[model samples]
Target: MKLIFYGEKLSNIRKLNGLSRKELAEQLDITEQAIWQYENDSMLPRIDVLNKLGQLFNVDTKYFFTQEYLIHKVSEEKIAYRAEDRESRKKTKLEITFVNFLDYYINFFEQNLLIPQMPIMDIREKTLKMLQETNEDRNECIKKIAEFVRTELGLENNKDLMYTLEKSGIYIVEKKLGTQIDAYSTVTQDGRLYIVLGTVKKSAVRRNFDLAHELGHLLLHDDVDMDILSSADLKTIETEAHLFASAFLLPEMQFVKDFQSLTRKSNPDYYIELKRKYLVSIAAMEMRAYALGLLTYQENRYFWGQLNKKQYKSFEPLDDEIPPVRPGKVRALLKFVLDKEVMEIEEICKEVHIRPDFLSYLFNLETDFFKPYLTTQKDYFGHTEVIPIGDFRDKTSTR
Candidate 1:
């Protein structure tokens, strides 16, 4: 029998868009029976019907005709040489699509309801230039970045900024998707952006790096038409993101001046004292010292070595004891919608563009942990009760 690719493609797109056959048929102005026939390979749609299907599903017509549909179930390596490349392209495309969708949704909500506008910062050019400038006082740079984010968003702290992002439909999930992957960010087809972190490297410093890197991708490279990063390119991107993150997290001039003043007494424990003030790793403090010319290369290397050898107390908490995972922005927004009754449970799942099963699993595993803290109930007697949903364990054992 000839392979009927369109049937599968149609079905996949329909499901991904969270549309039932009848619903899709209604949208396309076609009979529900026609959709059933098309999905079962009993009949193929005509060119007019194909065009309507493409528009309705927001997928390219070529996608239905190509063998790429069959490759979906194939082993990762056995697929086409460009499989990885194609997947990457698909992800980027989806990211842009989702971002646009979010922009629209945010606009709709603000106009129809009393929702606050989400703060958006376009730091792409600024971030790229930061990487190109040498002799840049790194600490001052970080401070400026942080101040910019704070001022733009009117946030007083990182926690507030995180809350705003979560409420604005961005989701950050912590999981080990793959080895050495660190983290990946993508906006779902329904317009929610997600940053999924690999939990293998649980160091707060590393997690900070991954978060900044993923944010860099979200802000700057989302429109770029490339998927795989070359080692050199990856390094360059990582460097830029690090600079952005550092500037954002640790403001330079303030930190430096503070460090200088704190160490002015020449106390042998000056570095240790400074680490406590900064909430940074000892290694980070050492780098800051070197950047400030407070320590020579030899001294910096020696201190780092000593740190690795556990000769001195490390500043940051141990990675194993305290992983850097946090509740993502996407979960926050979904919770808000559900709590506010702005969206029903099914609607929330549909808007976020996740399967009912997957959405339920994600909510129970991630959002349910903090549901109580985020929700409040009012009884008929005019008394308020706060329900608390505690921490959750991973439902997927392997992940």
Candidate 2:
């Protein structure tokens, strides 16, 4: 095969194996620049390097030479397919890569599980029908949904809920990938689903909507082609997801009752109260009001126009504060290992995919936290005594 075609196939295989160029180079004892060259079709790897690459990427050596492989390779790595476009100056390469990685991860998980066989459109219709028939209060609906998640996953708190979602193959990362993309969700190759949220979005309302939108995708459009969801067709999917989120967060019946109870006659104060109670944005509340026939089409239009003009504060409250950030997955895994007393600090660092320095960044301790957990023999009155770290948890010792 030609060098360019060979390089293209190599890149596809690398992505499929989830091996970054640096990781692959480290494994092969080669420079990352060399790996980049091979991926860019600028140079071909030596026959020995080719064989090693095949083994590392888990593809047969002959597979690279095939036309099918070349086509798949080109299609897979084409930057045009990326969620962000070239004109999007605000989006970084890291953001695009993270989103793509998330899609790949979700697809991987989905492929392993038996996703619902129903078509997404059908499911959406059915769910909407259920909502229409229920006539249940919004809080009751939210409580029910929360109960469903808790029962299914055995989650105890909001943090536990987040962890459960992650363990179930949902990917939520704490980084501002781009201004345009707050959060995104997608399915994996294996048919499992996932969601990724930008930690930079400090608003709980935004986070809640992101979660609900992702859940909408999972429940309403599992079988839809991912490409369609990324294209202009995405608008329809987004609209449906918005509806699902609004209804999921604030059922029509409860919202009407809540709105009626509020003494504030103006939309602004009413929205403030609604946002506080429901943990959703004022915009979402407005949409819910429109959907519930509380606000006429003209009223909805006027409200949005005022909002865009910045005439109102949009009901953001003083007490609506951002919470403290928690430790990420890698840190949490390390903590779990340390708490169980299963490994030394150095070993734990390696196992949890972090450097000692990075671990220090997560948890600022004087020394490695696992040092005190190690078992040691003590000399007491000439008798050798085994003093295990297990007793430290039993008694309150200053040391």
Candidate 3:
């Protein structure tokens, strides 16, 4: 039996930790070239150094030696980034790597468990089919699709959007994706759809809008090749998604009925009540109303002026009143697995070749989430038994 050292694993972990080779070398008290050598398979760290590497990264020492799992590879081209500055390929790569890690962790636990079938694929198919089958133009098509989604998902009025999305099998994760990015959506090669929401500027209404926008991307732009898209192409898709989100959140029929009461259609304050009812921002509602032809173009412009005058653009009324909804599906599933003893936390750590703390960090879980589930055994014969978890030996490394 022979053990192989995988340099790619070291590189990925380093990148995920946001460490440059020079920075990592400073921590390791080694030369920068040595870190590069270790990551490039030109040199292997000694036993003590390997253990230190594991401790630094909060992974089992064998993680560096073990063959990495083959989850769906995430590329920047496949991601719909909801940001203005989409130039950071490094950041994109880091995020995608993190998502892949999440994918592997999830797949490990969900192997035998029955989960809800993801509804996005079917919805996307139906949306495309409708586009082909109907004579409706793009905006009309989007509005009809949005209405259809609302009906299918049973999102009546202001029903809890986050809960419904999770119930419909969309894996949502709230992450610190910088202030520039609002959110991003991706469908893995295995058809697992994920929407990573940014925690920045995350009010309830804003979160809802982000979710709907990403949902629009998932349904409308799943087949788009983002790499080759020009600035204009990106803008066009963004506009389309925004329109979809507005329509989806504020269903035309219901919103029009609500809008009928606002005699002062140009007054931003008049839409506050509707905002509370729909749990959408005043600006968003104004846009929706204008899109629906309920507000004249001049009325919409006046509403914006009033909105600016009130200084409600950054933080609108009811932004604090409406409690932001947190994603609970992953947390709930983890609790269930732990409560049912399907897999102990420590055991899962060993299987995944990561430390319990790192595992918790990846999922944004509490620091002691795995503490209660960890079991302690008394030492016998002055020697603790060690069980090999994964293939202890491998001839080659595969990414």
Candidate 4:
């Protein structure tokens, strides 16, 4: 059924605000069912209520007048054939809100900002056999590719992966994507590739791994649409990406050479120092060692058992000391535009349909950092100058 006046925008806005129907209805002096009906397009609010909603949602009432202005669900949007929902819940609440934010961000930038080109490889699958192969083979393939990419960029095996991607023109955005989603990558219609990282709360080790994993997808699976994959196929692709991440971060030769130098092969504590050196998890280092044939299966089992016994499963030493890496590429682009006076910050905020405060929060910026952009001497005109507030008189005040 067609919704009335694209009412789903209301749903998106309400969810973005973290409001339930009952709460929103209570504030709007309406019944929960009424709000539902309004959101279903079966009804529309009166003019006054519409004005109130505009203020409440910080969107113009005219935003409801067209379907183009309404937002689609995240999974239902551009990367429609792409986002994999492995969780039992089809769409989590946080996922919905995050997608809405992502859509707004992508749209605003695509419409207004100029994006730089990234020097990324479009890896073509050698054969159906390769995609259908064992995990070890896939990891081997990815390792070579990752190493080549690093060499081309003049980056070391342990270099900043995020910085490299940013400098190479891949746009990255970091946000609290809830625990379920670590990251997702997609190419826009204009061919701009983006990696959105959600595990910003996790340690740098996990986040770095995620960035590489997504990069793996960006390079290797550019032609494959994830939505079309069977469950088995999905698992294989996920495993392939994971193997890529493992191999990419711990370059086989470099890591093997370093591991051989360690006094004890079985000590997880020894890997702790390696973890600091490589910026990867102890578990990952253990797996890499096992993958490299340095540790026998029995030895690997014993190593994991010892780690489990020592309670190093989740939190490890220096985990908190290492901050989660953030994506500065998009932020850098924004700063570039602002610094060059390409457009006023107010124009950016207005174009994005958000207040400066919300922009700051989304970008992890300080409060009132964009306040200077909001200062307008004239109301929508270039000519009118601000009359001093101190010069106002009781008889002829223009406050």
Candidate 5:
């Protein structure tokens, strides 16, 4: 049977590489219009051009001809970006494409093992029911929901937030999302929730806060239409998520008791101990305290002054000391399948229509995962040695 070219796949791959028609054309030695035509199915590329495209994309030539089964199961409009900027739409498109590839990978393992159930679904339903029953305001409802989530997770302390979420079937992916974007969360059509965190060398406290904030979006705003939300409306939503994050990370009763121990309410340095205990930033702790009426307006103002004067906003005391937790759900799952011989790396690549390196890049996995499957050659002593598949991007210039 003859295979037909799928132009939409070309567009997805191009966007995934952060490339534009003009830029890709320049690299392929073709006109911008030609690149556009090929992407829009207006014309087919020559065999040489197709070969070059495969090489540039680090995929088999047949990838372009194959049916694109792996698609963005999660809608971009439903995504809750922590920080949306001018380039957010483009960044979101790329990230969602990456998610589709990862979802495809996870689906491959579904035939062999069962994925865990998402606990957040139950938490959301219970919270909504409670809201309908009570006369609680929005913020009060958020606080109650946060407390309920903590109870549902069986978390006594603030630590292990990421681990607990992962165990509950939320996939936490840490990628180098640029400065503008800190984190985002979304639920796919198949009910898989994802929290894609930006690996910007943040403090553990900040990271935990980001995790909780995304979790808030996943649980609270799952049904909201984010695409039509105006700037002010989005801000309100962001504030709500922030409130949820703060309340969830720092439980009211626990934080209140902890605040009473702080002798100097105006001193930002004094809260470092609380920071150490809760694994929360001093700034966040102070805000949480103030929200709980532990600190007065003047005291909060003084705390802010000292915070800025000392420049603890960017680089806090424990920012370097307390390392952020690395995401392991996807990595662990992939490793399990590989180690169990469920599927060989080479076979997986062929089946997924992806290069090993590209697959690794999607999940931010180390290339060492593929080292064992490298090509082998016999030495002088008849001993077989591994020949590493060197950098895939060495042929193409960096984007």
Candidate 6:
């Protein structure tokens, strides 16, 4: 049965569901050979099986018939910081699906709207030169790199980072990933970088640190094409990203001055006070203190011991009190387009060729969330893109 559909599309949907052909065959009560045939485009699923596939994957049945396949690249290296035990494959599979969804969402936005103009920023030559000269001393290089980025972004100190990034046309999205992986950074086909953050509720400080960490990857590892990175290479890059995040969040000079003022340097309570000012974790503050040479080797060891003894390693004070930050650019863009009657909810769903529920999951929004803004009839055939009326010129700003 030769159907005018992409077999690769079926394969992609199955992979997105994190299912092997045999596993999916079992679920569908079909033979593994049959599943392979469908994915290979040698056979078409019965209408009943197609409906079941749609229901199983939460995609419309038309999705299978659509000729469009995932056109962009998926970077796998940034997500491999995992235990090499039994859960390794499971975690990697989940990460793959998550990246797939992200790619679709990014394509939807970039293909549809043009509000945020993301310009590529690269300083690989200088960063590479400095690292080579410093004997790959990321500790020193990281501080300089962070300071350079802070200066370039005009960020003298801590401010709403997402607001700054969004104004600069960097798209940010928060996923409700409760997995061990906190976040990952990927570049689009057009050289636009998007940072995906994990929305592990009740810790805005951690989210802020994660964004800085990802920003570090985008800036410092500009040379890395994630498709070709090995696990060892990923570990090296991850370490560099961590160093950059630490230095970026708490400037060495500023952190040194602040740490000097702490009366009880070892106390988490003392660090908690700094957390309020620095918008970092009490624990991160303590580590930052050590990093800045504010704590001696003995003092750092003692502080770690204290952290263990006080049961502050996993659970810390103000974890609940500190509200987590969210990415606002996507949400803001949706509001602008929908409210301006530029596009309706059904229109977007149709244009994106995604199920409304799936779109909702991608954005961490409610199902039928856009249903309210849809005042007119469903106009799915014609693409109604909003034209840029006036361009904001001269100085560029993120917020």
- Show model 4 residue runs off by greater than 4 Å: 1-8, 11-32, 47-52, 65-85, 88-116, 121-139, 157-159, 348-353, 361-367, 376-399
Clashing pairs in 3: none
lDDT of 6 at 368: 70
**Poorest 10 consecutive residues by lDDT, candidate 4:** 390-399
lDDT (CA) for every model shown? 0.49, 0.50, 0.78, 0.65, 0.78, 0.68
How many steric overlaps does candidate 6 have? Answer: 3
Expressed as tens digits, the lDDT of each residue in 328-369 for candidate 2 is 433343343444443454453333222343333223223454
Model 3 worst lDDT run, 10 consecutive residues = 390-399
As for model 5, its CA RMSD to the true structure in angstroms is 6.4
Window of ten residues with lowest summed lDDT in model 2: 390-399
lDDT of 3 at 89: 72
Please give, for residues 28-122, the per-residue lDDT of candidate 4 as tens digits: 99899988998898888888878888777766676666564535434423231223554423344544465557556645654555543445633
Q: In terms of TM-score, which candidate is stronger, 1 or 5? A: 5
| Candidate ordering by TM-score (highest first) | 5, 3, 6, 4, 1, 2
Listed in order, each prediction's TM-score against the native is 0.54, 0.53, 0.89, 0.77, 0.89, 0.82
Better of 2 and 6 by TM-score: 6
lDDT per residue (tens digit) for residues 102-188 in model 6: 666656554555544343243434556666677645677788988777666666546466666655556677775566667767665
Kindly list the per-residue Cα lDDT of model 3 for residues 1-399, writing each as its tens digit: 878899999988887676788999999888999988988889989888898898888898889898767465677877898545457777777787888888887877776577655665677789878877887688789888888987888887553787777767788887778778888988888778888887675678888888899888888887888767888888888998898899999888778998988889898888788888898898988877787788878887888898999999998888777777777777766755666666777777777688888877777777887776775752222112221111111121100
Prediction RMSDs, each to the true structure: 11.5, 11.2, 8.3, 9.7, 6.4, 5.4
Q: For model 3, state the Cα shift of residue 177 in Å.
A: 0.8
Please give the distance, in angstroms, between residue 54's alpha carbon in candidate 6 and its true position after superposition.
2.0
Name the regions of candidate 5 deviating beyond 4 angstroms.
1-3, 374-399
User: Model 3, which residues run further than 4 Å from truth?
Assistant: 1-3, 29-31, 46-49, 375-399
* CA lDDT, candidate 3, residue 11: 85
Candidate 2 — what's its lDDT?
0.50
TM-score of 6: 0.82
